[model samples]
Target: MGYLLAVAAAVLFGANGSVTKIMMEAGLSPAQVTQFRLLGTAIVAGLVLVVVDRAAFRLPRRQWPVMIVLGIVGVAVLQATYAAAVQRLPVGIALLLEYTAVLMVALVAFFFFKEQVKTRLWVAIALVLVGLAVVARVWSSELDALGVVLAIGAAVCLAAYFLIGERQVAKTSALAVSFWTMTIATVFWSFVSGWWELDASVFTQPVDIGGVGGELVVPMLLPLLWNVVLGTFAPFLLSLAALRFLPATAAGIVASSEVIFAFAVAWLWLGETLDVVQIVGAAVVLAGVILAQTARAGKVVDADLALTTGPITTVRDTAVP
Candidate 1:
């Protein structure tokens, strides 16, 4: 069930890319779109918390600082960076780069926690790099360096998301963590957006309120709301649940499916097509993800066992942060 939930988490995260792109194309700046999305998500997550887990929502005073930091880094920065990256980079390419947070976590463990890296681990990383080369069509052309940097920044922020989530996974409920984090993010985004004048060109029509236009005038689509609900809230909640059941690195690797799933969803929904080379690259990325998961376990049977039987017991939380 945890494995299925983790995969579902990936799909939800993937779906966000295509949907967010649509919203952006409608003229919303990445920051504005993210602010609106986060605001809506905060409302939903908060409602769920008040109704289902009110007590958990109230952290002790000592934990407040930790929660605030988590909210800033994990919730605000993690999402803001990704939205900005996707605004400039191809959604698939941007997402693939972001998913490299899996590797970042593993490296964090190796260098900081002194965990051992095996031969296969290195091979898997190599495979992913080679695969991404094809996916991004790097040899075909060069694009904006800043766009690439944003993608890398998004990946780093995502790594922080996992690392921070892990810090509280054992002590906190996933529901609580998600709810509080979103709440903090809402505060953070509100401040960021308070001074900025919203542009009128961000949507197809002026925003309607009771058949009236609001002062801001930014409009929206039905699908954009659906995107906020499913793409943003649902998947992130599932990821929090996965964080409860798995280590940061493991959750990250499993979540890598989010990118490939993004490719498929974009192809189907947004008419964003891919070439045979890109498909091959996606395949290689999947292979590397699988190889990396197995290599970390130190035994073929354990790896196969994990894939076949969901997350086995040996995929421990030790040394994971």
Candidate 2:
């Protein structure tokens, strides 16, 4: 059950890339889509906490600053940059770039935190760098410079999420941490999302569903709901549930499959295809990520993994990809 739940959550998160791309292509800016996603997830998570365990809301005053930083930097900036990267890059490539956060985390732990790291860390970094070059096809200039930059930026923020969340989880329940972080993210986005500039009718507008031929059309609200509920909220809860049985390291490995799922979904849904070289590059990068995961075996907390994982979930145990 734990394995199944983890895989299910990974699939939802993987599918989110294509879903996000569809919304962006349909005329929503990355910021707007991110705002809606965080807001909806926040409301749903808040309601769940309210009904299931209202005591989860009673956070200590000392934790408020950490929650705010997590909301603004970890949730808000990380997601918005990822959305922006998806708009400018292929879904798979964008996810691949984000997955580098695992490498970044390992490096940060070794250098900044002074955690004891294995020699494999250096090899993992090298593999990822080479893989990124191949995936981007640096020789041909196939990747967008801005998109790559944003994706890398997302990785940096995701690294911070992992580092900070690791500590935060030590002090609170995973559900509480997720809820509060999302609440803060919602508040932060609400101020800068330019909600006042958005036309109300846009939500009712019919837009292309963005598949192979771009023939399907649906109300904008459908995908938005899907993004919030299935993409973000459901997967998050599923990941948390998985932790009841799976260890953090095992769950993290399973969650890493999200990158592969994202690639497959994008290819099937968005008609995005990568060349043989890029595919090999992606495989290499994933290998490096797995290697990094092994380097810090049993060191990562389940709650931290949940919050920092691929796309969404309170106890999400994502790849931070």
Candidate 3:
């Protein structure tokens, strides 16, 4: 059940990359799409808290600063950068860039936080760097430079989410952390999202759901709703529920399948196909990510892995690429 749940979450998250691209192509700016996602997630999480744990709605004063940081940086900036990257780069490549957060977390834990990481971490780092080089085809410089930068920025935000949430997850419920952080993200993005300028007719307009040369069409609201419900909130719950039955390391390892799913879905749905060399590079990077999932020896490694594994986890996990 745990494995199934984790894979289900990964499937949703992976496919979400395509859906996000669809929304962006339908006339929404990355900031507007991000604002909508954050706002929708906050509402869903808040509603869940109302039913199961109303106390979560009232956080202590001391935690406000951390929650604010998590909301603005972790959720807001992470989602915005990711959305922008998706618009400018292939979905799989964008996700691969953001997933480097796992590598960043492990290295930070080892060098700065003084956590005991396995020696395998060094091997994982080398693999990731080499794999990314191959995937990016840095020699030819074929990938978009600005898109790569945005994706890397998303990785940095994701790393902050993991490091900060590692401590808070011990004291707070994951759902509560999600609710507060997303709420903060929604609030932060509201100022910059220019959401008011958005016309309601935009959602009612039919848009091409297919990417590149495809022809399938749908109401823009359909994918937009899916982005909020199935893409973000549903999978988030699935990942948290999976944690009840699987160790964080195991769950994290399983969640790494999101990258593969992203690649497959993008190829099939968006016509974003990578060549044989890039596929091999992706495989190598995934192997390193799996290794990184288990490289930490500290007890908190479980929390760390849980939050950093899947794409679009919450504060205790992601709102990543």
Which digits, one per residue and each the tens of the lDDT, describe model 1 over residues 38-94? 677767767887887889866888778867877777667767777788777767777
lDDT per residue as tens, model 2, 1-321: 889999998899889889999999998999999889888877887788888889889888888888788878888898889999999999888888888888887788788888887788778888998998899999999899999999999988787877887766556766676778777887888888887798878789897885886588889999999998888888878877777878767777788888999999999988899999999999999898877876763464232244332222223333332
Q: After TM-score superposition, what is the CA distance of residue 302 in candidate 3 from its true location, in Å?
A: 7.8
The worst-scoring run of ten residues by lDDT in candidate 1 lies at 302-311
Q: How many pairs of residues collide in model 1? A: 0
Collision count for each candidate, in order: 0, 6, 4
* Pairs in clash, predicted candidate 2: 236-313, 306-315, 306-316, 306-317, 309-318, 310-318
The regions of model 2 sitting more than 4 angstroms off are 301-321
Sort order, lDDT high to low: 3, 2, 1
Per-residue lDDT value at 276 in model 1:
89
Error of 1 at 248 (Å): 10
Model 3 over residues 189-232: C-alpha lDDT tens digits? 99999999988887788988867667888888888889989888
Worst 10 residues of 2 by lDDT: 307-316
